[model samples]
Target: MAQDFDIRGATVFSGLTPDDFTALAQVGRRESYLPGETVFSGNLRAQSFFVIADGGVEVLRREPDGSQTILARMGRGAAFGEAALLDGHPRRALGIAKGSTTCWVLDARGLARLRAEQPVVATRLVANLARGMAVRLVRASTRATQVVDQRRAANSSLGAGEARRSLMDRLFGR
Candidate 1:
């Protein structure tokens, strides 16, 4: 199963050559999590980057009222906590396993060591993170547009129905 989940497929390793991928696979450690497990929580120091090999994880944030809002849901082949390794910042969100999940987690220290020893790998990983961020932005924009469009259509139809009802009431003296 480990061999089947090629690290090259992960966004953090995108565009890397086969040799670079081999080097990364050598350095990363894979682990499995049971359902409802907390992969990491918001404001906590980030320890590693993960690429999901199977199942789902939820990225959530806590509101001021203490309610959790789901920021995103990621499934197989998705990567998370990647920027933490690059910037050494505490995680901004919590990641919880939605089900039994398999993930390849590359520790921050290991990634730093790899970056120092193999700069090209680092460069490729950076590119991959950028691409992933762009994709997320695009998806958010699309969803917002769809919501706006649906609201406008519903409002328009409601206005038209109201106008027709007013006309009928005036004509019938009701």
Candidate 2:
């Protein structure tokens, strides 16, 4: 179902032309989900990557203790379930509709078609995805570093003047 969606707004679709978007639409279909609906689950392999046309999707991860944590909230123009498509891996999290949401779904067949027939378009798409993923990686790395620092500070002996005393001792000959 080739519906009109401004795919240009999507980061992964950045630099794509109108004809390029049309080619993508020809390969994929548009789908809508209701609130609380499971768009994709960790148990399911990602058969497609979804670009939000409207509304949002909440990416959740199930913790070892049986609690689900929100990993991300993807708004319109954002793409989710892409890692699986790019890396040939299974989905590691669940994506649920936070509200009534619409997405442009490019399935494996579509991806293959793009790769084979429109190689330039496919290359651009992959490049954009890689750039986006790299930024996310950097952000995650920074967050991890912050968490480690916070944990170290919490674990350290910092009673009142203890930290100052330690610093002074280190600075001097003691």
Backbone clashes in each candidate structure, one number apiece?
0, 0
TM-score, per-candidate, Cα-based:
0.70, 0.78
Residues 4-66, candidate 2: write the lDDT tens digits: 666667788878887787677678788889999888885553657888988899989899999
* Predicted candidate 1 versus true structure: per-residue lDDT over 51-116, tens digit per residue: 889888998888899999999999998888766766778687888899998888887777777788
Predictions in order: lDDT = 0.77, 0.78
Q: 119 in model 1: Cα distance from truth in Å?
A: 1.7
Q: Model 2 off-target regions past 4 Å?
A: 1-3, 43-47, 64-66, 149-174
Q: Which residue pairs show backbone clashes in model 1? A: none
